[model samples]
Target chain A: MDFFIQLFTDPVAFWNSHTLLIAQIGINSIIASSMFIVLYSGQLSLAAPGFMAIGAYTSVLMDLHWHTPLALNLAAGVVLAGVVGVLVGLPVLRLRGVFLAIATIGFIEALRLGVILNLPITGEGLGLKNPTADPLGGINMVLVSLAVVLFIMWRLTKGRLGAAWAAIRQDELAALSQGIDVARYKMIAFVLSAILAGFAGGLEAHLNFFVDPGDQQYGVTRAVQILTFAVLGGSGHFLGPVVGALVVTTLPWVFQQAHDYINIVTGVFLIAVIVFRPQGIVGRGGLAIVRPAWWPRRARVSAPSPG
Target chain B: MDQQLLNAIFIGSIYALFAVGYTLVFGVLDILNLAHSAVFMFGAAITYSMVVNHGLPFWVACIVGIAACAVMGLVIEHVCLRPLRRRRAPPIAALISTVGLALIIVAAIEQGQTGSLFAWLWVDGPNSVAFPAGTIPNPTWHVGDLTLEASKVAIIPISIALMLVLGYVIRYTQVGRGLRAVAENPRAARLMGLDVDRMISLTLVISSALGGLAGILFGVALSDISPYIGRDNVEVRGLAVIVLGGMGSIPGAVIGGYLLGLIEVLALVVLGSNARGGVAFAALFLMLVLRPQGLFGAQLRERI
Candidate 1:
């Protein structure tokens, strides 16, 4: 309650004090958007964190060794992520649904445990320190990047590309029958998602003092959290996932009174929301509670027939 | 080398037991019960609490723990999976809801410190503690160049015998026939006078029971029990095991578990301990890409 009260009462102060939280929201929204892309394209690819890792490591390594500007570092990270995306996407895109999800999980765990944790340059388990981090000052960049990413996502969804994606999502065989190159469009969505995730990773790296290689950072847990954002937000619209990111990231703050039992509240909240709004918070229908089949209903009175 | 081989066989039994439940649910309902791992931890937690907090004997505690897990299975079906199924939501929605349930279960156990709301359930909070040394009878046996403890050796026979019993029940029982019919086609099974929902509920019961038993064995054998044993040890690795054997094939999951245990031990022996976790996932990736059907899975179908 205080969180919202302050936000409404003193807007400038809220922005000043809660800059890091806002920045994190921005980063999560971007990652959620990346998840939104793959989900929109009928692919359940969970390789976002893997690409994010690639982006984070590449950019942070460049900054540490070459002392390059942030823009060049981010660009290099994005490009390398894209290239790896193409390579990984080629073989993985053949698989569908849960298989794709599992394969991607395999990819991420293999990357984190196999590559990142082993390489000395990555600082291995200890993680690399980012001396150039600007936790407070990086807000503008994060917000701007989020806005740009959201805009691109909106435009892409409205164009021919989005239509192809929608077609593929509805029915792959039917879409193929209509002459839509199903494979190419899926690959495009996947690669685009990877690039966005990578970019978000680069920006996120700038917000922190250390580039930690923890499981919560770049592992299946992070992947699942990103998936939750897209899922809970409603994958139907571009803004749904952003809303999800906002709600989920701020859940801790909102339920602060719960203290030690916050997770219990959170769990109940997630179950209730998903059970009532399976289509997502921003889906087609207006605000309405989806009553289960067995719920009691009011009986209707019989009306007299007109003579 | 011989000791590692023996270790592989021992651990493989646990993997097979855990995966059997995972694959059973996936095979029947076609939903990955993410809460399954939580139940695995819960079973161990309950048994530990029963013995330590309540002062019950070890065998009685184990039985009570397994029974509690079976009840947890019903909770999962009624609370998480049922409503989503009623709504006809996508599989991913079920994933999220199950994750929600998992969070609740883990938190409940983690917050079970002294004087806390859940102190009655678990008093150790988030810390890892083992069963008291004398809680269960453990005798040591030594073979030429090999050492074995009865506690560890006990896991092998128990897991195998239980798995074989599960296989028999699934293969040659009236309840098994109902389960298979439902797995084959729920609507058809319903039309044929079999209660589909009941079968699903039964599936959860059996699956959760097995999962609980496996957890009890794991906690005893490894001498490590905590709120996170399931999440950290077998949650993801269970997926790898099922995927390796073939998703939904019982025999496959059994083989796949042993195969995974062997592979991990081999990786540990050859590439050192750091590579152990990595090699397993790398194997999972290659398996899905190169042979998505897995060893025992039929030709790929577009279920998901």
Candidate 2:
């Protein structure tokens, strides 16, 4: 009880205080929402982190190397990321399903390796350091960036492109027959989502004041966590990825606060969701109570040592 | 010139093994098991633990780990994949699930701390683990001017034997015939009273076990084991082998693996270490653009 009280009184406490938890939720919600824009189109991209890396790295490079202003750098990062998306999407969006997945995986891997190869550009994986100023300190910049990107995404996804994305995702053959250019719609989805991801990455880099090749979070593990969040939260709706991201990002933190076995808990959660709740936490419709037969109810709950 | 060629063959043989497993799974299921590399990692780490940490014999450790992967493969099929199949889930769902599963495995291994990557898994590290010189003691085998280590000599012949056995198993066995049936048409196979689910599960199990073996051998040559090594390079090489040889063709995987291996080695010799991975991938990208169906793969019939 004393620990909890002291935590609340601590300056770091506000970041986790019950009242401020809403802010954290809002920030995560934005990232998750952006994820949904791609997942909705049947593209479970593992390149979210890579897009972020691009945004972050480009921002830092432009700011330091070219002496660009913060706002201009941010815009450049988003635009560059979108352009990359379009370029990659043109040839790749033609491939369906696993082929596309593999191609994207290849893209992320190559980009990461490229960064390592060109050490002058990416700081040789040691990372770029302290690339931004505190207009209102570090935390506010993250919140403001999140809000702006989320607003843009929310508006765009609720408009014309979102419906087209839904149509293509539901049945590509039918969508094509109905005169929807499947490839074009997919490109839009990819580019738009990438823009948001890039923006997010830029903010993250500045906040942390460092950027590494590994910083892109395009790693297989992070991709899976993001995917799990989108699926669990309900990709079909606006708030699905938000719900998913919030649960995934924060659950580990909460668990870590109490014990070391966070991964085991998360793994069990993942297995359970896949087997029993494929639609995820915010998912609706039928099969809500029909527990899957394959998933064992008795999960192994063990406390893991520190990572 | 001789050293480069031998090194390529030595490295390529392991790739041949890796490619074979991937091609087998893709050939039969038409699904890319993205987690295949993770399975390979698990195999290496588990085997390493048994041998290095627990003091089991190397061969014993390898066998037990391979068996463990076979079981895990079966479980993956049952838990992650079977539902998708039952509902005829979209290819995207399977792809997403596999990617997610790959992350889960990587994280689980990271949590264990045993499979953490060494800088030299593919990149430069403090000291590249090298097998001691003259450990074999036999005079190096000479193919013209090419000098081959005893271990290197073993790879091609052993690979041939393994491939031959696999070929026989697929061609001569009843289970193989059922697998062929399902691969050709799942619905048709089911209509013919074949246990489609079981065949799919069996395919994953066998492929993952083979992948497990490949990982162990790879660790020996590299003189290191790291979870990060295989995912991209192995997948690209496997896919390239399949594309160049033909998808769903086991013989193609073998031929393509060696061809690719040789090409990469020659390129590395001419180009440099830094450009090796890039050159390999660039060649694959070009191959994909030029001949998507591969040299031997029959063009897939378009679904209406």
Query: What TM-score, computed on C-alpha atoms, does each candidate reach?
Result: 0.98, 0.83
Look at candidate 1 and give me any clashing residue pairs: none
lDDT (Cα, tens digit) per residue for candidate 1, span A24-103:
99999999999999999999989999999999999999999999999999999999999999999999999998889999
List candidate 2 segments past 4 Å from native.
Answer: A1-32, A133-136, A215-225, A257-264, A286-290, A295-307, B87-89, B95-147, B227-249, B284-291, B299-304
Over the stretch B80-162, how does candidate 2's per-residue lDDT look in tens digits?
78876655544545555665576566555554533434211222212223323432344557777777666556767877888
TM-score of 2: 0.83
Q: Interface Cα RMSD for all candidates?
A: 0.8, 3.3
Q: What DockQ does each prediction reach against the true complex?
A: 0.81, 0.25
TM-score of 1: 0.98
RMSD of each: 1.6, 7.5
Clashing pairs in model 2, backbone N/Cα/C closer than 3 A: A261-A304, B246-B297
**Model 1 bad stretches (over 4 Å):** A304-307, B299-304
Q: Residues B1-304, candidate 1, lDDT per residue (tens digit)?
A: 9999999988898899999999999999988899989999999999999999999999999999999999999999998888889999999999999999999999999999989999888999999989999999999989998999999899888888888888898888999888888888989999999988899999999999999999999999998899999988888899999999988888888999999999999999999998898999999999999988887776434221
